[model samples]
Target: MPYNTSYVPNYIKRQARMVLLLLVLFTGCTEVIELDIQEVEDGLVIYGRISNSNSANEVIISRTRGPETAPTPISGATVRVIDNNGLVRIFLEKEPGVYTMQPSDSPGDFGNSYRLEADVSGRIYRTDFQELMPIIAQDELRYEIGVERDITSSGANIENDVVRIFGDSKLPSDLPEDFFIRWEIEEVYSTLTAFLPVFWFPGAGGRGQCYIQNKLGADQIYLLDGRNIRRSDLNNRPIITRKIDNSFQNKHYFNLIQSSISEENHDYWEKVRTLTITNGSIFDPIVGKLQGNIKSSDPEEEVFGFFEVIGIDTTRLLMTNNDIPVFFVDPCLFLGDKVFPLLTVPFGCVQCLLDEKLIEPGCLSCSAITNSTSRPSYF
Candidate 1:
């Protein structure tokens, strides 16, 4: 019997987010139109990542679905990782189509080559060996406030304040001049619930202080090459930016993770970003299948996605309302006495001073409005 890994819906959800972001950025100012996308038989979609940490490595396998359908997990597959040292570690499925490295397995080492192999329904699939690259540390993370203009759906121009984050790093002279890098960002912040109820109902949880963490989807592949630079150190390079909103209400932290990748991996992501940007354009080049390192023993089989071993470095920065000199009103307003008749009370009240009516769902629990409730230790 073949053991399988656990299914993590978030993994694919992130991929979907990446796709959506690319579409939004690439198709700016285009007229709203729909194209008939043809349906085809589902193919294999694999997403895997490996790093130099002790944490468990993961790979997600699912069958591609139609444009209107969600992907379904592929099960009963044997998965293994082999290093150039000839040592092989088998992965067990914790859930359908999700494979994870055993806790006892050793973490990937830098300067070593690793390959992945999967046997699904007697068909063998494998990836070309990828070498682990050296990690590069970020020297600094900086930001700037500016204005951005956009045309609304109704053809009106709207200008909004925006914040852009930038990063810098230095390349040591001893290292090779040719290199590839990838960037990712995550946000952590706290939210306040208006009221806390003293008496708890069976299913009603009191709301007070809640925190949430979200990983922002990066639309563009932030791949950089040392060969393109004349200096030994990379100057201020832009990472990402966002409009000042409720997320920056009290305090927030953004973490930027930088990964050094192989030239092949860099090219793969570059092609993906290009294809996404040029999709549906008359001047667009023929969109051929973007192939990955993964391959199948059967000549007729098709595979999608990449498996990578990367060297990573991270830097975190905190931002507060003070950072943005602009003054904005709180979007989440208090219901006040008007909500008493409707059974919707403010979040801070312990009990209804006047009536026994139930409070609003969101006022009762902060988690109800956000995906996470636990505050991060660093925050």
Candidate 2:
């Protein structure tokens, strides 16, 4: 996935924190109250990750829904990170509750320990100083076509082919045995417009096909526990699987990112993953709040969510339609105008290519699709 400098909401990421928000909403349960746990005054949820990649560091502060209030962003707070060396680096609020550090300032370093401090309304919330570990680069990413069985909504079993990706990683020799690893996968694909409707002249050639780039699966998380493994090299470890679809019909790139995280961070996410599976069943009992490392000065006030410091290494693998064992249908294929219900005319009817099917934006231009880019620089 492209490195984003701006603040993106936790809900938008669809990460583990989004599920934690559900706990904030169900705090009135008798089981949680019996546990002597009181909700944070504002239901504060502060989540952020600062990495060696300066451009991707960001902090998001928002309130979860309470008894009578809807969730909202927390604004006008002072957010900063301080290192063991006494260097205080302030993060500026780019949006309401999103803060990003000035990249030109002191970027994150691997050896140093850092602490996050947020001052809101004279109350201070902070996390214990967490040390950043050395980056662990991915050795390689491998993929193969495999068939998997799926059940339809009507309960009919069917088989579908999918692309399964695996990864290889060689752990650093000097690292402690207690270190943890996390893998994140992202997919970028390209598409082209089948045809262009508007023409300046009778002979005007079809507007050159617009090549659009799209991204997917950036929020999924995969974790690995490195403490027990005696071997240094991890080979052919299963990473992720994606269904073979139209996105594979073009230049598709799978980005595998590896990061070394603290054991505390790993445990927090592990709890989330466990809760997520149990949450699927309505019969399961609601889980109480999963406290994070963030702490507040007032004993009654509790802060939820984690602030993590990590170093990430990424590897990209490019695949095309030729990579798939079976033929994949092209979304842009021109079967017939009737297949596309919407139509429009882009120019004057005289010289304009006035096909009713052209009213569909994708038929006229690939740019009509969301997150579509005309040129892919990585090519």
Candidate 3:
């Protein structure tokens, strides 16, 4: 045996082969888990154009890509553009989901970063950076709200509370007169899976009939005491405010509880509502009344409302980092040496994007402007 160590026995060799075969059979199998991406875009397609002074520049955002549709037609979307600083530079709603805007000043420039955001079904999405030489500023807008009449289903009459947008800017007389305008109202209830879409009256002459869609007929819209627009009409001159000393105080449902744990200083985030109503486009048949138990009125339970462009939040991403930087959607400002990536942080609850990573938004340094005085001195 010592002289023929290399010459192993056939029986020993057979055992070695069997051991190797057994190991391969037991440990050499594996499988991969793949991700399932749902095809989206069945919702309304709201896309639009933004006209700027700096030549023509297109706004594209992947996050804002609407859900999946059968035969998706890209046309007719109401497009809105956010400037380098996170401001709603351009916002116009088309028939479906198309928004269009002209350069309030000039076309977007290169090197400047801009973010594109959209609101659909009460959920909002923002796009990645569209680097341009410079992002132009769309004429700023001043928004207000008004109150009008809201008829009921079974015959209960109620007043309607409406949002009025009074922007001070130059109106183009060349562009065809206000032919028609359509807007989409997105409503989401905690108990429902589908968001309620309320498409309302066609407006002309920069005004028309529009109301909250999908109301339970009985829900009456409320008009806050003093909300009206400037007009020459006798009855509609100043939006008439009908006071309701009854249980349904429109201000009752305005107190929205906000957690101070993480927040930003934005005028829009301020809990109080400071909107004035316009005369021409007053609320006629508004839906959904401010309904709540007035017993021991708590500001937390009041049903708050929307005012205008408060801020832009980015889509949540699953990445190595947790704190996503917040950036102003200003297209004019380019990345300086001190600036990090043009940031947009996501809001609301989000599951892990991709896999094995987490992305969430951080508190911003800007302060939210509160309209405490705007709400009537009455509680």
**How does each model score on TM-score?**
0.73, 0.73, 0.20
Looking at candidate 1, the ten consecutive residues that score lowest on lDDT are: 278-287
Report the lDDT tens digits of candidate 2 across residue range 5-91. 222442321122232311110111111111223333457777787777756577777775543343467799999999899998888
Model 3 — TM-score against the truth? 0.20
Q: Which stretches of candidate 1 lie over 4 Å from their true place?
A: 1-40, 147-159, 199-211, 215-217, 273-288, 326-377
Best by lDDT: 2
Q: For residues 1-379, write the lDDT of model 3, one tens digit per residue.
A: 0000000000000010100000110122222222222222222222122222322223221111222212222333334566677555664432222233444634443345555555443344444444332111112223234566767898888875443322121223333211111111111111101111112111101211111111111111111110121221112112112222211211122111111110111211122111111111111110112111111123342221111211111111011111112222322122353122222212221221112122111111011111111221112
Residue 122's lDDT within candidate 3 is 39
Query: Which portions of model 3 show Cα errors greater than 4 Å?
Result: 1-79, 102-105, 133-379
lDDT per model vs. reference: 0.61, 0.62, 0.23
Model 1 clash tally? 11
TM-score of 2: 0.73
Q: How many residue pairs clash in each candidate at the backbone level? A: 11, 2, 82
Every candidate's CA RMSD: 7.8, 8.0, 32.1
